[model samples]
Target: MAGSRRGSRSSKKTADRKDKNSLLGRWLRRLIVAGVVVGLLGALALGTAVYFAERSLPSYSALMNSENGQTIVMRARDGTEIVSLGPSYGEWLYSDEIPQVMKDAMVSVEDRRFYSHIGVDPLGLLRAVWVAVRDDQRAEATSTITQQLARNIFLNSNRTMDRKLREAVLAMALEWKFSKDQILELYLNKVYFGGGAYGIDSASRKFFSHSARQLSTGEAAIIAGLVKAPSRYAPSADVNAAVARANVVLSQMRKYGALRADEAASVDVSAVKLKKESGGNSIRYFTDWALPQLDTLLADSDSREPIQVWTTIDIAKQKSATAAIKANAPKGAQGALVSLDRDGAVLAMVGGTDYVESNYNRAVSAVRQPGSAWKLFVYLAALEAGYTPDDRVVDEPTTIGNWSPHNSGGSYAGEIDVRSAFAYSKNTVAAQLGNDVGFGTVASMARRMGITTPISTYPSMVLGTSEVRVIDMARAFGEISAGGESVEPYGITKVETAKGRVLYRREPQRGHQLVPDYVAAGITDLLQTAVATGTGRAAQIGRPVAGKTGTTNSSKDGWFVGFSSGITTAVWMGRDDAKPVAGLYGGTAPARAFASYMRYAVKDRPVEQFDTDLQLPQWQLEPDDEYFYGDPNDYYFIDEQGNLVEPSGGADNGTKSPFPPERQEQSPADQPRRPSRDNETDDSAPSAASDDFLERAIGGSLENGSTRSNRPQQRSPSSESEMDTGRSWRSNPPEGIIERPD
Candidate 1:
């Protein structure tokens, strides 16, 4: 019985062992199937990522010939290079032409496994990932030379995983298309160094003032170190930082067997030389103004090659204009100047005192009220409407609608000739003329004269209360200088590629006549009278200059727009914020700046005369007119002896004027007579107005109608404030109007 029980228990134990074995076999099969599914999912995810990344890759040709930005070389009219815009590129060097040490240093510092990898280094990536996790930082994948070239040429600096995947795909594509040597050459040629340099050759010349072919070990080390942070490690920026980084590169070179210990030690970090930096020139303003035009001119061209632009700027005149502004612009105030030839080619432009301090181009961009300079358009309208210089105009206080306009000194010369009224800048005369001829006509005249800014139709607009650009003012004056022809200002003359393929060449165009020659002559006649014997006496520069002085209310803006010797120039002075300058006036600084610049500008040019046949009217004091001195108030009057005397009765109570009756009785022969139009060949001749007449007219004595001297001891309040009330009469003559002796 015991034997039979043992046999059955043995049979039951064998069956239990079979059941356990079967269960183990089924679980193993299920685990194997799950592993295959997981592997398929990971492969699908990687393939999907790569497909999206490839879609963003640039074409092969685009990748090979990529220029990150447009390159332009601007030259002056004389063919001298004024400035270069965008990245500066040097000659493309081949892999063989590049020094071996430069290549070695670059590879050792940037990517040690560059040559062995197929664009994306698996082992290096794994090592990088491990290091990142160990240090608790983001993984810096694509840490190879080909990967860097891919990012530099085809991608922006975005640290997202999507961009990283694209970078990796582009790197592999570049490796497949080109040989390793070609990829290395492209990487070196297209990498950006500091100072606008885009190639190793350019970086070498820019930083060391030498070529890449002559690079030494230390120089190569410095250049190689710049790839990490060009602006930070540029030798021109921080020499110590550059040398320290270069030393790290040198140590890597030694570790990679590129240099021996002694060879690396021989590199003298202190002996590194750098190119000297030049001072910032104002030519940048010219480039900034011309770049947009260049884009427009080359709009049809899709070529990415470097361009050579020939502009109309005269470098000598540009330098002179810059110097004049620097010398004449008042402290704490800004100034701008623009010069145009008869055909309206921009010769010289000074946007501010210094281009480095501010790049805001005031000449072409800033719009400010022109003040009395606006009178040019008003008077031009009058001349176009059949009014001659000898025509009559009343200079007394006048009202238009609710606004009343008064002269500068509140003094009125009743029923004066138009020439005298214009010369003295009579506001009432201008307003009456605007009202009579129509302000719309005046605005249209301004547009015909090349003023492109919006015009206001208010009566105050006749007095230059409207805003205009300095360039437009120059262009308007250029119209008169060009013999009544319309003028369009231009800078670029020819545009061509570096390979000499012509893209654009400006054709010589003659502007149509916008005004009658006779009208232009009449306007020039009034301008001549203004400069010769009127408030514009401050602009006399030993030549027959035709210009007007403008001062806004509160002395906010001062301007002088004039033309001489076939050149029209405009000068403006004011605060950028439109705040009042304490003693600033158009006649004081702007007129002087114009004279100073024109003296140099026209020194070599021949003298030109305005074509005018109108005769200036002889101004005479009436018998009932009283000559008041010291602010023209009722309290003071100039006696016959040129003495200030207080009248016994108030000026309103019909007090007999201090005895100036005999002064008016001088015969015509004794009075200074203006030269007749038939005999006046040179408008620069001595003024016909005598010193006594000037003393009475301007409340100041004069010597030769150029210098102020022996003025009355008492001064007018208007004169003391520099006549800031819109070119008012003053005791002292305007500053800086020196007439050269014959």
Candidate 2:
């Protein structure tokens, strides 16, 4: 009975074992089928992705002809290349034509298994994945040359899985369609090397100023290093960083046995020479200013070929202007200058002291208080009001509303002629003139003189409180230089393709007369006097120069805008933060820079004298004397017929002056009081009075003075708002008025 029971147990155990084995086999078979299904699905997904990616790929011909970006080469008026705006390209080179060292350097650094891989390196990919998984990091890219070429030709730089998949598929297609040498040749010709350069040939020529065939081992390594980060490793951007990267490439080459360790060590990175333009980066300012105009000129056209822009910039003058600013710009202060012809073609521009330090163009983009330079429009308005340069105006302390302007030194000439007042930059005279002519008339005059900035009709706006651009000042002065015609500043003269087919050519347009010829002559006469004997005396270069000096409150901005020999130039100096500079005045640094620049700019041009038929009052002062101190020979006394007459007695004669007997040798109490020096204020500060004060003050004087019967007749204002219903101020009229004699 025991034997039979044991047999039964054995049989049950055998059945249980069989059941366990069958269950194991079923699970194994299911797992195998599941793995097969997943593999097939992955294959189908990859196949579908590749099919779409392949269909979207560009044609082989397109790949060969691809460009990184449009190249716009800018040339000066003399046909010298100033700068290249877009990516520069060189002639395409085949595989054999490329230097072997360059090819070897690229292969060793970018991909060691480039020759062994079909399209992608499975070993490299697996190693990258294993390392990533083991180190818990992102997978490293292991792209072959074929993959890089594919990406450069047909793909944007996006790192998504979809993009990666497409990149791999296109890479495989490239490998299948072309041989390794062909693929390498295409890659070499299509890669970007930064500094606005594309392709090995362009990179080689740009950096070394030679063809790729002449690349030494070190040069090859340097160029190869740029492939990873073109901007960071470009020699022009940072030479030391580029050299360090080249050493890494040399190490890779040594490891791959392409270069012997000794040869690699002997490579002198310092021997690599770099190409530099004549004017350096400073010329970029002119190119930058011209590029936008080029875009506008080509806006209506549909041509996409590489273009050549012939700009009006003179490279020689550009260099001179840059040097002038660099040498004369005060330390810790920035300066900008713009030069224009009478017809308004930009001759040269210096946006800042250094283009590399900062590219913020102050010449055309930055607007600041023009200081007394803005008085150009004020005096022009006065001229339009029929006031002669010799007309007598009080320079005594005057107030409009609650605003009282003062002279630079707080010294007032009790009663002065208009020419001396303007030449000396008397704030009181400017304020009175703006009020007399109406602020609206002043603004209109500015607009007509090529000032596009919005002008406020504020009482202080007459003293250049409103912000204005340097280029606008140049254009305004250019209008005066052009003899009353409107001036429109322009840079680009022509645009054409590389094949010389003209796409856009600037057509000459006749400038409409913005100001009357007599008005232009009158203003020019005053400007010339200002430069000859006034605050702008430092800007004189032994030629007829017409300009004005301007300094804002606390010396925040200094300016000198002048014209000579048919050229108008404007120079400005100030801190970017609008902080006051110590001892800065428009007649000092700005005038010096103007003189320095104009000396070189006008050296080649013939001397031309101003054409004006208006006779000016003679007022002579010693060269050393800056202010008029009541010279008898320089005085113009009013005659019995109300016409101006020179002092007949001269300094030696003690003859009675031709003036009202009560006005001769008046005491301080009888004249307008000068403002206290300690309480002096900037002329640009707006009055604390009501906003309508400027409008009400127009065509009137706020001073207490008696009108003389011999006073010159005031011309009617341009509009109804500027009607003169108030009497002119003549406070304590001197026995004789100072004036410049012709």
Candidate 3:
């Protein structure tokens, strides 16, 4: 028993000594860790100081310099202002413009200790760090009003230690440079409230269409709410977000003793109406007229500088042009109107009937087949290829490659002069000419005149087979009207820095001559004749006018391209989905639009003929005695250059029926036109004796007032014994969905 007690005592002594050694080791380890931590903290502090000392100083002279940049102002030739643009249409104002509620709301939400903080708020930094460290989440509330102001005006929003140090440095500099009230004023004026509006005044006017001097508590609260996230809190834009933001601002105001709790609660959140209206509301014309040129001219620079866009666009011309489209286009239809000066300056472009409602910019963006409009290009090529206006060409069934083109009327005319062929918009004649001219030459000529597109030498190019934009067509027509000056259409005149430093200016130089002056004149003469008596007769105005009507196969596209001395206008109406409009014709729709536009575009502009020297091809002359004795309205059709000529008479036209021979042929170009299904002509006439009269008309070549072939066997309107001929019925879209596509 005595030995056992002694062993236990010895074990206890050994255990105590080991415990002491362990305590000593722990103390030494803790001392080493503490030293390392101290050293690291010292190193970090020194490095931070050195980094800031070596940093480059900020230069805010660009912001301080008050040389206002050039403002883009669109005007008419007479200096009538159409639109104006500024740096968001804003100039900073201080307490004078801000209301009491706005000031209170701003201070309440942004900074509770705005007046007491010295550029660096140690307490705020500590709170931010603590939140960031807790559960290792990012800190959210680290900035003060002064810090935010520094970043909003002079610094970019970035996350880096250097940026934070810069913010601290700038805030300190601002504190030393300005008083609290002055700082507040600058901050208030500088903070952004979107909608392209910078200052409170602009924002106020944009939202309410009124000045900031007048604001109610609810309006002020909503305006102040935008400070958190301007784009997100736009009232009319995000209704729920705006309400939430307003409530937060209102809550802050109450907490800051700027408002009573119950008073804030009593306010109607719905009363926060946005000062800025939504949508591409106004300035649609600016975008429409400027974007295309901008896409081409703004080679390297982003669209950030204020600019001066000196344009030939006349506001009155555009308004009148748009009015015409609306009055003529079917409801829900889309339309494009493009007008240019004789010098090739685009005078007016209404991309849509109303630019504000749609922003697709159809005038410049849409590329569609010109239908018969392509025929004019073909005619121009043929006329240039030694073909005379009175020269006869077979209008019978013809095949170019695999595609066989038919006249709007199913049956073909044997022969017709060049003038009468185009006046009647003969598709088969155009195809025949297109095959002879080589589509490549026509495409080249079109390119020189500013028709930028990939032109295939396909036979269809004769009938406007190539697809092109309305703007491009307008540019080409402008070239013809300009007598081949080769003008490049431009919109922006200059762009400058905010300090009035010139950044850019548009100077379009004349490139190449497209066509001889005389060639243009002769063509214009034929176009005038067409307008006066042919398909485009509906496009005539009280003044001298020239135009061409284009109705594509199946009436899928309709166009009326015309020109006056001061402006060349083109109107196109169609469905966006490529559907046909039943019973619609270029003469009926787009031509009417052209006439309506001319009613106003011709104001104060002189009627001038295109100065061309080339003589026209042999045209059937209506002798002075004959032309004078008959009604002036009987034969002449106005041309693009505002002239007139007589149409060609084939065997059919030789037989006078008051209407021209081709008048019975005009319709959709897909299939030959015939009597309506209900009144369709049969294999036989109303009587056998009538066949004798038909034989006389169909005796020899069509030019000799005869048909040598079985032409009438195809779709002769005189036939009788009826049977189903497998004709398909085509219809246009609903009225509202139709837009004029010429």
Candidate 4:
């Protein structure tokens, strides 16, 4: 009975201890739950306070569409900044205009979860905090694209707790107010792009010399990579570092499937040509000349805000031309240069030696005597008057209306073809030809070609006595370069407002034919010969070139007007006071300048041959002339004018065909005659007379007025029927042939 009572007391004590332990555990769990609830409420209250605090800071309505400033930027054909008026505000672009590769690069490298995030990313923030603590980096940033835009345009950038809160709050507000594309557009245009560029357009022009819309993938990568540290990886500052950054962006793009592996590998970082930003003021003669025309170009527009002007000025060619003139011209003598494309777009223009010292535009305004350069118009008139290049004209001393023009140094070749006369620049022969063709006709021809200056119809005018601007000469030569189409030289292409509104635009007008194709071809050959072997030989560039050399009576002015298939340029060197330079001749200083500029200008262009064929038998051959003979074996083809044609095929190289085939040794009676019908009248029957037969065979007419189309006609030898219909073979030469060579 005692043992049983002791067991019962022990069991009661154990059960009481267990019940106390269970109650203690329940109280501990309730206290832990209450602490967690308080912590949650505190966090929610802090976030609410931060959101409202940022909401009261500033309004973003005015800053949304506001332009940075008003400015009129001028850009070259390649979108290089030539100059800017007022403050620099670069070109603006819509979000869609930015390349997809560029957009993808930005998203993949900058904010990978940009599209999915609601302005603030909590996971990214936690990762960023962990990384900062683990790596001991105080400058770590986890802001999304929206957060960046907020910091850039709305709030100031600072690495403080309060600033971070404000940035996050504003970013959330921006997310609610704008779409993803609008937010991205704001970010792209607002971010600093180094080199004083604030937007993608400005950055593109500053570094790549192109618009943002035209940026290549490599170029876009380089620009997008600049956002990390603009000054650190600026292409102009260090191209290698910029390229390295671009490769990183490209790799990130590939990792995100925004770009293919093959695309990333094929991108050539070296091929991204960057225009180095230059210091010091550029010569502004071209801008100064183009600026005055704004009134006329924008006459219809009423907006007076600053407008961007897109011009055809090639900065590379402009600098080359300026350097050429500065290096070749004499110390005190002023020089001017004008370069144009075949379509009459002004590629380069240097009005004076120093535009800061003198704004007087010599290339456009100064009208000086062209000297022998003016003889081109006289010769063109002679060609229009039915004179062949092979027709002989006397270079002897000739007196015309009390004016006896003599060749330079009293030297004259007694009898020479018009080609030789022009090549050698014989003044006497030119004056005689001018008188023969009538000075009025030459003046009219000059006006028709491109010379707008008033010309005096006199014998001295043939020697370039009339004053002409350098640009006019370039335009006339540009027509020749384009194979006979007249072009009006223009600089400014169009003007646009800051918002991309078209203020004014130039419409392309079709040019008219000033010189016939055959006449232009003949002139080109003669000019090419002049450049190859004549006085302008100093201007040879080891390529086919056509040019002329001009020196006035007292050496007061020297001019060299030349053209290739790509460009036409005119260089003039003279003193401002019209005083003579000691030894200035067109072939010396002017030609040297022309060659110096042309060598650099055409270095990147392909070597194109001239438009005309050099081996055609345009000249009548004398029996004793052995140097100008054609191939003796070519017998199957003939050109339109009954001259032997040289086919571009077969074993025969560039050799011309012999004038007459050896098979024509039989007498007239021995030759085969065509059969005639007995019922036909004598006039209707084919003629037996040599003159009539030759005329009938070639389809001759007294006054043929065939005009060549703008496109070049095919001259292949296989089109015999076509050639036979439009050909003319003169039984006797024209009236002005002086036959004897002295």
TM-score of 1: 0.55
How would you encode candidate 4's per-residue C-alpha lDDT over 57-121 as one tens digit per residue?
A: 44444554555433678999898878886433466677888888778988988998899898888
lDDT of 2 by residue, 1-742 (tens): 9999999999999999999999999999999999999999998987776667667666667777877767888899999887777877898888889989999999999988999887778998999999999999999987888888878777766778887877888887777667899889898888889867788999999899999988999999999999999867888767888899999999999999999989999998877888864445677778777786765787787666899999899988988898888887888999999999878999999999987656668998899999999999999988766566766677778899999987777767766667777777888889988887788999999988878788889899999988999999999999989888988899988899999999999899799988777778888888887787778888999899999999998888989999999999999999999999887888888998999989999999999999765542222211111233665565444333223343554222444344521112223333322211212232323222211222233334434432322333223244655443211212222333232110
Alpha-carbon local distance difference test for all models? 0.78, 0.79, 0.65, 0.75
lDDT of 1 by residue, 190-245 (tens): 88886689889999998888889899999999999999998678776678889999
**Candidates ranked, most accurate by TM-score first:** 2, 1, 3, 4
Model 1 backbone overlap count: 0
Please report how far candidate 3 places residue 526 from its true position, in Å: 3.0
* Top of the candidates by TM-score: 2
- Sort order, lDDT high to low: 2, 1, 4, 3
Query: Which runs in model 2 stand beyond 4 Å of their true positions?
Result: 1-57, 60-65, 88-279, 615-742
TM-score of each: 0.55, 0.57, 0.53, 0.51
**Candidate 4 residue pairs in backbone clash:** none
lDDT of 1: 0.78
Please report how far candidate 3 places residue 317 from its true position, in Å: 2.4
- Cα lDDT tens digits, model 3, 108-209, are 887767778876677877887898899599876567777877787656666888888778777766666567876676666666776456667677787767
